[model samples]
Target: MITIIAAIANNHVLGKNNQLIWHLPADLKRFKLTTTGHTVIMGRKTFESLGN
Candidate 1:
């Protein structure tokens, strides 16, 4: 199964200045649970934005 998951606001604005504007812990938990044990792919910018 191929599922595309995204967190977007009503305005369809993804991010500003390559950074997320809001912090949602619940969303993060859900994302972790959903993609657990699966190979997730993301762009370079996205990967870099989520720093280690």
Candidate 2:
């Protein structure tokens, strides 16, 4: 099963300058809990945003 996770704004904005425009603690917790122990996949930009 492949599960893709992302956050899109109402204006269809995904991110800016390789970083998220907003922060939500609950969302973060959910993401962590859901993706934990999974083989996470992400785009190059998203990886860069995490300073990888």
Candidate 3:
């Protein structure tokens, strides 16, 4: 199964200034649970943004 996860704005916006514009604790928790024990994949920019 291939699932793409991302946080998008209500205005249909994605990011601003190369950074996420929204922060939700519940979403973060869900993200962790969804990716746990899974081989997560992300774009180079996403990894860089995470300071990896």
Q: How well does each candidate superpose onto the true structure, as a TM-score?
A: 0.80, 0.77, 0.70
Collision count for each candidate, in order: 0, 0, 0
**Predictions ranked by TM-score, top down?**
1, 2, 3
Please give the distance, in angstroms, between residue 38's alpha carbon in candidate 1 and its true position after superposition. 0.5
Q: All models: lDDT?
A: 0.85, 0.84, 0.84
Candidate 1 lDDT over residue span 1-52, tens digit each? 8889887888998788887667899988998899889988988998887688
- Using TM-score as the measure, the top candidate is 1
Q: Given candidate 2, what's the lDDT at residue 23?
A: 91
Over 1-52, each residue of candidate 3 has an lDDT whose tens digit, in order, gives 8999978778989888877788788987998899999998987887787673
Residue range with the least summed lDDT across 10 consecutive positions in model 1: 14-23
Residue 32 lDDT, candidate 3, scale 0-100: 82
Off by over 4 Å in 1: none
Q: Deviation in angstroms for 39 in model 2?
A: 0.5
Model 3 per-residue lDDT at 24: 83
Question: Which candidate model has the greater TM-score, 1 or 2?
Answer: 1
Model 1: number of clashes? 0
List candidate 2 stretches off by more than 4 Å. Answer: none
